[model samples]
Every structure is written in structure tokens, then in C-alpha cells.
Target: MEWRWNAVFLVSFGVVWAAMTTAKPVSSLDPADAETRMLAALEDQYAHDPGNAVLARSLAETYLDLGRPGLAIAALRAGDPANLENPMVAHRLAQAYEASGRVLDAYATADLALARCARALGTADAPSGTPVPRFACDARQHMALSTHQEALGHMLEWGIADPARDARTEVAYDLALRRASIASAR
Candidate 1:
């Protein structure tokens, strides 16, 4: 009876070990290979839902991850213009623009996204006791911070002083600060 119990335990352990070894963790894949696989999956989804804003945005992000900012821009542009108002879409587009060295465009896109976020949050004078929502303000602040960081990154990449870079950075910092203050006020 003891031997029979031992045999069952060994078989169960072997099955568990086989399952573990057969199922590879996604993190174990090479970064490049994983990215390629993700891009292919995103592309397949996009093909099935050509007008899907979410899929388009995800595809653009994957392209950006693959260091193909130009393709990211194209993918984003191909999506419905109405979806551009989505803060996430706008933010990703700005990132792609920044990656492609279009600093002004990136700043403008980021600014537009921030504005949309603010608008979504309702007017600034919205009742004194009203609870301030979190997501839009936080997203706006993130977009501003990202724009500022991207500007600095571009400056470092180009190895040259851009007169507008400082101005953009200042504006971004101010925007971020304002957003944070608003959040705190609530």
C-alpha cells in the first residue's frame, strides 16, 4: 500500500513537471522576437477590425516598441480622425512624432491632448466641494511630463541647442504643475 501511494505521487509530480517545462513563459522569449510576435498579432487584429481605434492605437504602440516610429505615425494616422481626441491615442501619436524628430508636432499634439483631458474634466470653476476626478487630470499631467522629457531627450540626441526646446519644456512643466495642483485641490 505504501509503494502504491508513492507511485501515484511520482506520477503526479512527473505530469506537473512536464506541464511546466512545456509551457514557456512569455518573459523567456528574446525581446526582439517577442516584439515581432506582438506586432504580428496586433496586425492580425487590425486587419480584422480595420476601423478599430483600440487596435490601431495598439498597433502603433507596437511599431514604436519596435523602433519604427515612422510606421507608428502611419498606423496612427490611418485610424479614424474622431479617435484622435482619445488622450491615449493623442499621447502615443505625440511620442511617435517625437521619436521621428518632429519636436514641434509632438509638442502640439501633446498640448491638444492635455486640452482634451481638461475639457473632459469639466470647467475649472466646477463647485468648490465637488470631488475632483482622477484619471483625466492624471493622464494630462503624464502627457505634459512625457512631452517635456521627450524634448530633453531630443536635445540630447541632436547634440545641438534648440531655442524652442526650452520654451516647450517650460510650458510642459507648467501644465503638469497645474494639473497636479488641481488634483490636490480636490
Candidate 2:
């Protein structure tokens, strides 16, 4: 009995000591470090697939989330300029521009996104037999209002007195509000 007790105590102490030496405390792990590592991984992926809109968008979005809007803009621009079929890519680029204090760029990008959104939602005229699929339209519709609002905000903040500013701003805000209502109903 005495020998068994001594063996168990030794085993327990050894286990405790191993755990203490091997395990890091949860609080000691830096979240920023993890985020930086993830950003690096994303950059590697983007480098390998520069033409991939989804990968580029993800990388740019991650950079934007990390408060590195310049990096985000660079990622978005790395893709083909004419291949912004994914409206959200343009939307994210617009957001990065806004965050980086490039209001004019933001307005232009958001306007481009809005046009893509319109086409995706079937609001733009197309061949009579070809309508946008319901699911596809629904997927893109959610972002329409936000994109319009972004455009309007950027235009307002551009601080230039264009002759068409009043009409354009009104139209943008009206569309944004109308889309918001439509979105809420869904």
C-alpha cells in the first residue's frame, strides 16, 4: 500500500510539471499576432491567384478589417480592372478608398458597383428572353442600398460644386431609401 501511494504521487507531480511547462496560458496568446499571421497567409494566397476575384476580395476585406485600407486597396487593384463582375469587390474597394480618405475614388468605385448591382438585379435592360435568376438577384440586392448610400456620401463629401450634383445626389438618396424598404420587406 505504501509503495502504491508513493508511485501515484510521483506520477501526479510529473504530470502537473509537464503541463505547466508545455501549456501556454490563454491570456498570453496575442490576438494581433494571430491576425498578422492570417493576413500573411491571405497575401500568399492572393499572390498565387491574382485573377481570382473571391480570393482578392477576401484578402482585401481582411486587410480592411485590420485597419490597413491602403493594403486593401492594393489587393483590389491587383485584379483586372475590367473584371469587376463581382459587385462586392468594387464595394469593398470603395470602402477601402473611403477609409483611406480618397472620397472621389470611393464615389467612382461605388458608382461602378451600383451599375453592376443594377445589372445583376435585372434592373438594367437586357435581351427579352434573358432575365437574371431570382437567387442571383436576391444575393446581390442586399448590397444595393448600401452601395448607393456609399456613393451618395462620397459625392457629398467630395465638396465640389458640380451643376448636376443636386439631381444626382437626390437620385442616389432616393434609390438608396427605396432599396432599403425593399430589403426590409424581405
Candidate 3:
């Protein structure tokens, strides 16, 4: 799913880049020198190797940098990112949608990206035979920890947490109880 979206984003972004180069401001020489240069370069690239994906991605990123969010997103969307809804793609798509004044779509994409991140974080630490997926500790362990819990874990683990004013202390204690409950349940 993620790979598919990555490809679409790459392509859409590439074409947008090529277009941006062509769409550069007017030049003095022959009036169309910039256009010609842009086209020639794009054509040269397209002709040299239709299978040059790196070039294509570079072109797409270039388009994104040229303030042509529409073209860049389109190029990227042409691949799996549009269909797959990966977090990175969702993040970019949200950006593009926001730039295009599509507030709702932007919000939606942002939400999806957040959800994907959360989901990934949740299932990252699964024990081999546990009823529920385990949390990965120390960034290497994958666990479905809540935001507060995760913060608490990091603070406690690192010993930098202030006992007097930390909101996460209670959260950590609650999580401990929950873990105990789960252990007993199992």
C-alpha cells in the first residue's frame, strides 16, 4: 500500500517539475528561449530513458520547489501514494490540498497521515504470543502506547522526569496498572 502511493507521488511530482522548468519567466533571447530550454531538457530526459525513475522523482521534487503544488502533487499522485494513502504521501497530499485552497481535503489527508502514524506506533511492539500487541520499548520496541503513556515512558526511562510537576507520572502509573491487569487476564 505504501509503496504504491510512493510511486504515484514520485511521478506526479516529476511531471510538475518538468512543467515548472518550462513555465519559467520569459527570457530576453528569442522570447521563447526559456520555454525551449525547459522543453528540450524534459524531452531529452524523457527520450533518453523512459525508465529513469530517479530522474522522474527529481523532476517531481523540482516542480514542488517551483511553487507548482498542483503539478507536483499530481505527478506524485499518479503513483501509489494517491491510492495507498501512506503517511508520507498523505502529508504531501495534505500540503498540496491546503495550498490549492481545498481545506477539507487537506484536513482529511492530514488526519489520515496522523492515523497511519498512530496505527504504526500502536502495533510496533508485539510479543510473539501475547493476546494484544506489545509496545516496542526504547524506540526499538513496538507498543501501542498512548501519547501520554509514551511520553511518560520516555521521561521515566531517561530519568529526566520531574516528580513534582510531571503530568505523565499519573499516566505511567495508570499504564502500570493496565499492564498488570492484562497480565492477570492472560
By TM-score, the better pick of 1 and 2 is 2
Task: Kindly list the per-residue Cα lDDT of model 2 for residues 1-186, writing each as its tens digit.
Answer: 999999999999999999999998745336579766786787887788787777877987888776789888887887666436566777788778767767677777777666656666666332335344222334445366354545456456646334143455556556667767786689
Clashing pairs in 2: none
lDDT of every predicted structure (CA atoms)? 0.66, 0.67, 0.50
lDDT of 3 by residue, 61-84 (tens): 555555566865675556433232
Error of 2 at 143 (Å): 4.0
Give stretches of model 1 more than 4 Å off: 1-34, 123-186
Ranking by lDDT: 2, 1, 3
Clashes of 3: 27
Candidate 2 weakest ten by summed lDDT: 126-135
With a 3 Å backbone cut-off (N, CA, C), the pairs that clash in candidate 1 are none
**TM-score, predicted candidate 1 vs. hidden true structure:** 0.54
